[model samples]
Target chain A: MNVAKRNNVTVTGQRGAPVVMLAHGFGCDQNMWRLVVPALAEHFEVVLFDYVGAGRSDLSAWSEERYASLDGYARDVVEICRELDLRDVTFVGHSVSSMIGVLAAAREPGRFARLVLVTPSPRYIDDGDYRGGFSKADIEELLESLDANYLGWSATMAPLIMGNPDRPELGQELTNSFCATDPDVARVFAHATFLSDNRADLAAVAVPTLILECTQDFIAPREVGAYVHAAIPGSTLVTLDATGHCPQLSAPEATAQAILSFTGAAP
Target chain B: MCRTEQEQEPERAGGDGSLTQDAAFTALLEDSAVDLYENAPCGYLSTLLDGKIAKINSTLLAWLGYTREQVVGRMSFTDLLTVGGRLYHETHYAPLLRMRGEISGIAFDLRAADGSRLPVLVTSAVKTGTDGQPLLIRTSVFDARDRRAYESELLRARKEAEEARREAEEARLRAERERERLQNVLVTLQRSLLPPVLPEIPGLETSAHYHTASPDRLGGDFYDLFSLGDGRWGFFLGDVCGKGPAAAAMTSLTRYSLRAAAIHDPDPVTVLTTLNTVLLERYTGREPRFCTVVFGVLEPEGEGFTLTLASGGHPPALLLRAGGGAEYLPTPGGVLVGVLPHPPFTRTSTVLSPGDTVLMYTDGLTEARVDSGRALFGDGALLDFAARLAPATAKDTITAVTGLLHGFGDGLDDDTATMAFGVPASGAAGKPA
Candidate 1:
């Protein structure tokens, strides 16, 4: 089925170098890693891809029964790795994708070498005293937020947002078409992301893992980072001096430097 | 008052009056610019690139119920929103505005200072510096209390319409299933009223066919050939007055009574007289049930069969001879069964030599509509059809008549039943041709 085209896979940097696959989280596409790609690509082969139902990937491949759970997304990751015949690779995931990588690596341990989880949460809602940094009602509020921005993701506004033909300069600035997706597809992805609890799955990680946490992230607080680090034995947790959940965009240099040091790719 | 002063000054000193008017106009313009920014109809706010509120107009402040000192520097734009709105701003709104440089007509609800939600539509644009770098964000907010209420009402009505359409589709499917089930029951009942297979008569060729016009309604035509005793047989063909379950019930009664009466007395006239008494005793009310029937008895006699037949207001039986001739055996002055106390049934006799056949049928054949429903096929057409098949065996004659009936197509709108029997010609005797 052409896995590379279905997932919009793009490969760059030096050929024959060690491979580093970057996976984006919910709400945005692979363009979220654009800021940190150049630095990582200098020493390693960098790979970026959008999940099905996001970015320019084929939307027709999406089905509600298949994509209703995180396992479907994990299957996409495993298939993409198999399609490329990648071996001993390092995987970087953001937000909900961090859990997805854990699932993929566990299924095909031979394909992946190391894991990097950026501002991830094993669970978003508070369970017992775990302090996942949100209540059950708060996640429902996030679903309402998705509905409130219905007009933004509608097809009528997509062309205007993706390419401003009236102003060519604006079009040049928006080369990647960031964060625009079908509203129905986005809703299902949001439900799978925010409601999933992967606490038990974290113990199955067998590779060297690095968990990067932002100092003031409301979506994934420092507590969730510590929980993920403690759940995986011999995992290192590094707190970046950033304010938002997306440290790759907010603090790209530090995010890339941490990855380069862990993989021994930096000169 | 100003107009009166200007008019008097123009007459006294025209040059000084023009200079005073220009000075007053400049003062009015300066005052209005500042007032318009503070009290515009919609709210306006400007924020830093990171969403920290840098400046806000007084009209927006009044709607938020916050003083200038409390909000100007202490809160970011996300802080003023509800929990849901903050998530939306991070995931969809901020990322889009950063990429597109401008976004318009997005719905959001801001939590006011008193814990109330104020629905509003927001439009934002990035204000760039001279070097083509983003400096700050400029936002305009419009109150949407009335619009949101109207939108919810429209959404509710549309949902109701979709649900009703789904229910109607389900109802139509259920009714179709019910009709199919009823048709199955009618077909099974119709089979019970006819014999599964006709009995084989020794040394005689026999064949019968029954055609029903509608699957939904049970046809009332019936025919049977059964042995009466040693070297003799009794047979009958009839049609009840109507169709469906009521006619089917009357047909069942008529068939059983004729069989029982023939067992008691194999005489064709006496058997019919007994059936007439049984039907009249059973069905005699405002809606009297009656039928036209022909009964006959056959016995072997010197290389042929002797046939004695009686009619009760039924169509005359047709005879085809080995000598290449065909004609009807008329039994006149007969009355319909179940309609009178002592109706006289007419009796007749004929001999079937080798290859000679006698055929009994209901009026459904002659009464069939033809010529685009303009006229009936009539008794004359039946005689012509029988004559064409003269000198033919019993089975061959029946097959030819069946084909002619099929040619009528939709014109054959009633149920029909036909039975034929004869002695085989010469060497063909005792073996089917």
Candidate 2:
């Protein structure tokens, strides 16, 4: 559970250069960057650490009272940047971590130079003017499934990943990683990631940004990624031919190349 | 599936095309009824008017762990409920549903096959046909396990918050009560240090008043008037350096010592010197306590009184002349008592003519703060107040100063003690000009 500690940092291609801080999403930790790091670390100094409750990080730091909201996670990101004295950081975020970084960068604009959002979503529940993939009733069914098979969440969630699965076992291996997290911690994080709405913060980002969209994703669809790009000022939108949520694991070469070209780092 | 095909075969034998279509539609309706009755999410059940179970859907039957033959004719709907749920159904649920012809979302419990209780919400409605006659009762049921859990959590949080709030309020109340008790003890001790009514000195109108800034806290002011030997009167007013029960104890000692010393020698200087020795002996420890007192002895003279005043670090007395002039009767070279072995006590003699008032007050009056824009109501303001009513009696001066003390609003942050003795100007004691 020492994932909060920085294990290894690679700065292969450049010295005394701008930093690229990568924050992972709900289930996975900093290990999600194993494939993309070898390519981007050749040019930029890659900073990685797990969220306190995720992976092998310190579980004692996760407090139900304090971490009841996503703001606690976002504040930790800002404090970590301050502790490392990182400036002009090109923040790379995946899944729900994208909004976490967006909030952190909005709170302190001077710390972050740019943002590379991967499969970002603002509001997952649709209002009258919005159309998220699932309806409220569908989400209720998902909650019921979670409660019914409290022990078999991973086995059930794997098959529900995509409608057309050319790689069915890929979803199973990815869900196997999800089951590694403590069920209680996973439950709280599930509520926090799905229930948060940061749509208002999309326009306030004053940094250069790039948003990578999956062509076929059940969670964050192409329309949703396009909407995020439209709301954020001066942000570029790039689409990749990946299907599943863990794009770096599904297609690492394309994801790393996009990050390198957007950051203008030699790879 | 075979039964459905057998039922649809006779409909295909009809020669007319429209008749054949009607027969096929009837077969489709029957198939949909089986699906709806078996797979519906809500529990549907029917009971006789007397509460006997007549028919039930597959959902309700599966929930109760009973087959079609077990409960259809043998038991009533109340048989599936727990003891308390059954009682409520009879007393509250049955009567309300009967009077209203419908009742919805009434929470109850049902006993399952394994004797475990199942929480459920039920909505029962009396099914009536075309003639408006009461028929069988149809009820819909929903599982309430999740709602009940949520409700219990909300109740727990509410009870915890209420307990925390009550504990905080109790602490505040105890603090307030302690302050009130301290103030009561101080007021009782202060009264014991002064005479109830200033000895009814002949040819003299004497009056005294004490004003407290806060009734729930103690103050350090003291005053008294008592008879010396051979028709000479002794009086003193002083303010201690601190507050609470300690100040009240010192005020009592000072009042008694001055009264006893003045009997042997009615000179104000000797009376204060005796008090100084008593105070210095009583307070010999580190951080010794002390006070400022002004002692006076009044003796009858021609058309006026001879007043000898002695001060121990006390303010000068204000002497109001009969013809409307006010000035401080100076008694200099006085230091606070109890700080040293021998303290210098200053004595001065002044004759108050008839119809003149002498006012002795604690510094609380001079140090009172008023409006935000003005300076403190200082000694100059008090002198001007005394001059405005020069031709007033002792009672008039005392009453006027008491009203002035109240007029300070929240400005008077300490206790005030005032005593005035003089001959009356007119008929009544407090009849103002």
Candidate 3:
């Protein structure tokens, strides 16, 4: 597939501006960036896209073998850059997408110049030596809840934790999109996200990175953000006053300012 | 109307009789409303915006065996759930209710006063004020012991279904193993039906090859050369009508009958004629068997071998002469054996000089498909091939023909049988010495 169509890529910014590719997390589509994209689009060329199984992407292109791991997602990132001939790209990834950027940049460090990780966690379950802030049984219960209600659990859980009841549109939109994802794809994606162990992949990230850590995030806790910052070379960690995992929704202005500040100071 | 004391009491209490009746009715209605809420069959509770219990009914209190004072203002709705249920309530139930403004039919287990778990289905809604701000949450609880028991039945059925699927898989695998074992048996059977080893013929170099298309069944093609007494030898190649166990039986009968009949006469025509009579008598049943064959008798001569061959609906033998000439030794007026009671058979006579090869093959080679299944390797191609290999030895001719068959690849789909005989030249002389 052509690069633009495969990931539902949409490029909009100044003609000669640097490319800012925004990759959304697992639960929602590219609509996850609706609040943050408007500000970033003015200063840099912002690229928004949905993963293959999440939004208006071509589902026929999905193969169980090809998408069995996160490496396939990284391959998509590399191909998108190659297809568009994008150089010195600034990749911004949220939740599970953050590690996807880390993996892509590690493989092709020449293509990327900066990495911005929003609520990133290399692993969710805690092992003996490392503290990922969640137990195995906790994750199993989360999966069982997903199996029981699919979108009902995430759509409702995301908004309450995200805490934007004043704006009902955000929660309602998320609920509809939760059911919109193919349940099979969502289940596989959950396994890839929560069961992955990519702590070693952080050392190979040569590009300057910015980690956006939010307060009170039940998904990726504050310690995970610190662990990511310590592992990535020459990486900066910015703890936002935003309360939830998605600062882009709960606190869009702060999220935008932090990103703009990082890119300006990164070079 | 009867001036009863109960009726007069209301009039006595208030100077206006209608006012007294209104006062009495108001007290009665207020008492009934509170009683209905307290003793309703289901449980009812209200929580603050922060999930702290603000008001609870006596019915829910009775189900939990908790006093109203102990539950109210002390515990949130999540605190009343079991440990696992609490996690679910905090993660999914509460979030969904807050975002959607309501949730219904959620299954949860509430920890009772004595720590026994009570299964309940809860429905909750967020209460909003005139300004559309959520003030509190109102929840109704229903006992779901029966529903829980019923849903567990599906689990049992699912386990049974899983067990059934595994057994079906095992049966399929067993069937596959049986098929493999049958193929092995057929391979051994097919090997035994062919000649154990080609008999050594003095003064004549001989070689033969057989190819079967698939491993699952035995081919009908057969060839053998056996010695006849006093410097004479009998050789034959034939293809039975069909394949498999039945065809193999017919082949064994024909091979043994030819050997027996040839021993009695040794002439090519008499040997085939004797075998034909036996087959006609044996196969006269409803399902008859027939074949095409070329039987030959060879006699030692000075610096050469003389061959007399008889045909029954078979291709003529090809002669690769020592002088580099190759052609078919035509034998005419032949018919298929065992089908007719008096099938006319014909014979041909030829001589194999030193370094000359006589090649006989079943129709499998000449009639095979060669060019991308688009055309057959017909009689013309075989003629050209024999001419190319003129003056070749028996071993060399057989080897070259096998190579040609291998090159046919996917196009050659049938089994083939071929045999060649040659008289070797003496050293220091290419021609007969």
**Candidate 3, TM-score vs. the true structure?**
0.57
**Which residues of candidate 2, in runs, are more than 4 Å off?**
A1-267, B1-31, B159-183, B426-433
Candidate 2, residues B121-225, lDDT tens digits: the string is 788999987898668899998988898678657756876898999999999999889977877776676677667777777777888998877675567788888
Alpha-carbon runs more than 4 Å astray in model 1: A1-24, A28-62, A79-89, A106-110, A133-148, A152-186, A248-262, B1-35, B130-133, B194-433
Poorest stretch of ten by lDDT in candidate 2 chain B: B83-92
TM-score of chain B of 3: 0.67
- Spell out the clash pairs found in candidate 1: none
TM-score, prediction 1:
0.76
lDDT of 1 by residue, B95-142 (tens): 667656888887788889999999999999999999988899999999
- lDDT of every model, 2 decimals: 0.84, 0.75, 0.79
In model 3 chain A, the worst 10-residue window by lDDT is: A156-165
Q: Model 3, B140: alpha-carbon shift in Å?
A: 6.8
Give the higher-lDDT candidate: 1 or 3: 1
lDDT by residue (A155-185, candidate 2, tens digit) is 3542343221334454344422322344456
Model 1's alpha-carbon lDDT is 0.84
Clashing pairs in 3: none
Instruction: For candidate 3, write residues B1-433 as lDDT tens digits.
Output: 2246447675465457756766777666666878889888899999986567999999999999999999999988877875445545544465456556887877777889899877788999999999997889999999988886676576558668989999999999999899899989987887776787787776788899998788887788888888888778899999888998999889889989988988888878887788889889889889889988899998888778899999988888898888886899888988888988888888889888888899999998988897678899988899899898887888889999999889888777778899999998652233323
| Candidate that beats the other on TM-score, 1 or 3, i.e. the better one | 1
Question: Which of candidates 2 and 3 reaches a greater lDDT?
Answer: 3
Residues A14-71, model 1: lDDT tens digits: 8989999999998887778887999988888998888888875767788988788899
How would the candidate models be sorted by lDDT, starting from the highest? 1, 3, 2
